[model samples]
Target: MRKIAYSLAMVLLLAACNSESTDKSTAEVQTKQEVVHMEEALLGKWRGMIEIPQSPLEIILNLKELSGSISVPAQGISDFAFESIKYNESDVAITINLGGSLIKIAGKLKNETIEGTFTQNGQSYTITLKAYTETPVTYEKLLIPVAGGELKAALEMPDKGTGELVIIHAGSGPTNKDGNTIGAGSNNSLKMIAENLAEKGIASIRFDKRGIGDNTALIKKEENLTFDLYVEDVKAIVDYAKKDDRFNEIHLLGHSEGALIMTVAAQQNDVASLISIAGIGRPADEVLMEQLSASLPPNLLVESEKALQQLKAGKKVETVSGQLQSLFRPSVQPYMISWLKYDPQHEISNVNVPIIILQGKKDIQVTEKDAENLYAANNHATVHYFDKMNHVLKDVEGDRDQNLASYYNPDLPLTNGLIEEITKFIKQ
Candidate 1:
């Protein structure tokens, strides 16, 4: 069934985020209902489009619901699905239980037309799905420039309505547009979140990092890049969003390292709002040290301690040998150095814009303590602390190991509460 595959996709997406503390029982506890398949229930083939107001990039969703399966053509990496389809005659509404994610479609259903927002992953999308009579629609990728480099981004917006723009900055690795992962990496986790955000009335812009994808123009060579390069790319995206009339405001939603980028960009630009998802609250150096120390075995931790000493002493870590080399390579060394340079608490404190900080209690990367640190730094910012979310902003059972495993899956959708917090903040 398409629902089964889509469920698998979500499984992969969150697979990597799973670690020793991920818990799946909670998600499985969702209520179940049985319904008879009704031909008049508005089931079958449905057609819809994801529109971006500023650009011509539109994603076509040609979904087919048959028996118990749902197949999506653009299922590139994240296979979206509905576990069960239910219709209510009183309100002319439909409820689609997409895996653990739920979306309620409500609007006038007449002349073979249905319109409403699909609620998923915390955000709401303005959707209009029509019964398909022709071949499924094809999707085309949209390319845009960020930090003077070309980035592949997808957009979804209403034809003429000026909506809010949510620009999703990629996480710490080389990720693509669909959120499907590459290279020791997972699928486009951020992209999956962005697309789900599009289903909710918000337009999202997600792209490959500078040194990755078509963005190579901005990234001279991977070996020579630094943290500031990412900050500049965020600025470029913000600038582009500002010039586009399609959005009334720009929402900078950064995850993990991207959150640091957003913190930097907010200082330099005029952004409508800020959403720091699973971002570090302490200084990068401190967080790195914490993460390394927490994840590494005892022996490796001892060696890492020596490297940290070298770094703190202002000594080049290159002088270190053995396992230290991998920890302090030329490429990663500069980034670590540059990363250690900024104090997130200090930087976020300087941001005058409204900020919403979300952290997953089960996250192995940016822990709930990190979110608290950020919130503490800015006492006035809105903070939503969720106990069930992982670093990728997906709900997880508290088994840390299983949660990290979800990170590699590349099939799961982000946590449901992520977009909801963002939307609630924006609306406020």
Candidate 2:
């Protein structure tokens, strides 16, 4: 009787263990099914608008089963992959690293819509997304070979060929081919210019310089970048355009720092003409010093002036203040030193082609005097001033607050007559 009882207890223990295993397997399958269902609901293209101040910018999110990417058409950003994406049955969180800036989105999945708060650099904005379909691409992507690597560029050709191509170079910093900086949001000024030119039956090419946008891999070290390197890059683009049989006449258009680069590049390349938009006429060091004068304290201002002088002399300062690190950082000092060597006034005078100088009277960064200085230097240059236009080439009729607000407004049209003047210049 004791042996039979022991055998029955063993059998019961085995049955209990098998039952537990079966239950665990069922739970695992159910969990996987729930996850798959959530993914199915979340996958696809989502369209939304970021309710930024004064404007609503459209954004597109494309999700796969496990990964996703985003696009801002206004900013010319496409297929920028997400850094991290965490989602559950009811909620989703996304993080994107733009250069070094962080853009975070937290949303709740409600039926077919995803409503979220888009946060970047401490500013929060509302965004709502629904199912979307992507439009066909209108521009051609080109990789122009440079010294270190190739530049990622876009070519926008008009439907009607005009045999004229304008190469557009953006301003300094991390500004991309679309003229949008990472943290500054999308202004699409350059993109607008390109489209406007295309509408006028002119082809245009814009590019992401080294260490910016898709060309970030071009420069492994910031210290290696120089103003001369920028000029060479522009020359490379010019060379690329020259080789293309589609274009008979090649023109160069540069904004801000790009204006200086094109001025020097035009002297080297066989381009037809050059256009300078809101470019600094004075030495970059002088312009920078003037800009910092109002913002820095007396002591820091003095130090910054000294540092600028050293950089202008082709020397790097060994020690920089904590507050001034962004401007005087050692890695960027070499580029500054090379940039300081060029005087726009002197460089513009050397361009052997017809020159157009366009400036905005309301431009806070560059003054009307800058346009006048360039005109004074170049004998063949014609200058035009937009009375209501700001630095980003937008029409802002109100106070400084309104002027700044236009910088982030992609829908804001370029100042009236701005495109007409450019078209007239190119056609003439």
Candidate 3:
């Protein structure tokens, strides 16, 4: 009887172990079923915050899973669409082609949460996200009575604490608050500058042109947007800065075309100081001619030479294709032509205020000569040039090809020298 009892006990133990195994298998099968049933609605508008190493920006992904088309909105540019959204279930990957850059996302789904990584320009970053239903939009209409026109302005204060206020005006193109323009092109340099300033307890304000970003309402009326019109806008911001106690002083910092506006605004406003980055000393037309000549290789040098002549003669060159329209547009040409009429050196000479001229030696768009001319014209202005810095104010070196690659890279921080110099000058 004892032997029989022991044998029965061993049999019961084996049955219990099998039952536990079955229960575990059943749980796993249910989990698999739940995962399979969870439809990846990558469709619709997904919104999240992206933290690239250098700075953080808001992201809006308008994705259509079936068509493989996605729209990305960041900075001031909205719904700038891209093609080919490919997915991999095993790696939980999603990728899309953005202009010349490839944007890759590695995502994982757990229960109801979705998280992942995003890589751009050879740099990878962690981006945690969940399925969001609400679409993110960044545009508002505001009235500026001083400017005599209701425009789209970021009326809200900057994320940074107010110490000194820096107002940025974009260059020849429509540098919307987001640093982007349709047809032409936009860079995130302005946004990057704002982020760095925030870290140093400095505040900044940037706006779209009369017609760009939330200002699209104004663009319909073309006559409203003259160079002077833009200057007036800067004045309105400067007035705000002066009246607001948060800003100890207001500094006008312009990039490219905005730089020209700064020279004009500085002459009129009681600005604390002025800074010009990648600004042209000559006219826009002359800069374009010089740029085309410099960008072309030895083999294509002759074609570029003839194209320059056509441009000078007020005729568009057919052979001068491939990114030419981006630099020279009919809408922007008038501004560029008008800009060429005024010399920045003469403008800088008029400013009695202290000035700092920072230029990137490797900036192909605006050469170091442009900065030199401004420095030469102003005997008292402080000048600093970085041989490795590019137009975006990021540290760069080597051939033109490698330098240009930095344009699309979001991971690379803006050159440390630029921030230190500008901050010191503003404080002084």
Q: Rank by lDDT, descending?
A: 2, 3, 1
Residue ranges of candidate 2 with Cα displaced over 4 Å: 1-61, 64-86, 93-136
- Please provide the root mean square deviation of candidate 3 (C-alpha atoms, Å): 18.5
Predictions in order: lDDT:
0.60, 0.81, 0.62
Q: lDDT per residue, candidate 1, 1-428, as tens digits? A: 12332233343234212312332231232323333433364654565532212111112232333322222222221223334344444123444444334555454455677666544454444656567554232223566565554665556553333388877776775555445333333544676666556667677777767654444345443356778877877777777677777777888888888888888888888888778888888776566677787577888777777776666555656665554454575556666666667788898998889898888778877778788889988865878878877775567784778887777666666777676777778767
Residue 414 of model 3: what lDDT? Answer: 80
lDDT of 3 by residue, 203-269 (tens): 8777777655555444433334567778888888787667777778788999877888998899999
* Candidate 1: segments with Cα more than 4 A from true spot: 1-149, 158-162, 177-181, 185-188, 294-303, 309-315
lDDT of 2 by residue, 1-428 (tens): 12232232233223322333322221122121113245467778888887664345567887655667776643435556676677776677778655456678888778789998988767678988889675476799998989976788899999997999999989988788888764456688999999999999999999887766567566656689998998998888888888899999999999989999999999999989999999999999889989998899999999999999999988989999877877887888999999999999999999999999999999999999999999999899999999998999999889999998888788899999999999999999
Return the number of clashes found in candidate 3.
4
Candidate 2 Cα lDDT to native? 0.81
Once model 3 is optimally superposed onto the true structure by TM-score, how far is the C-alpha of residue 326 displaced, in angstroms? Answer: 6.9
Worst 10 residues of 1 by lDDT: 50-59
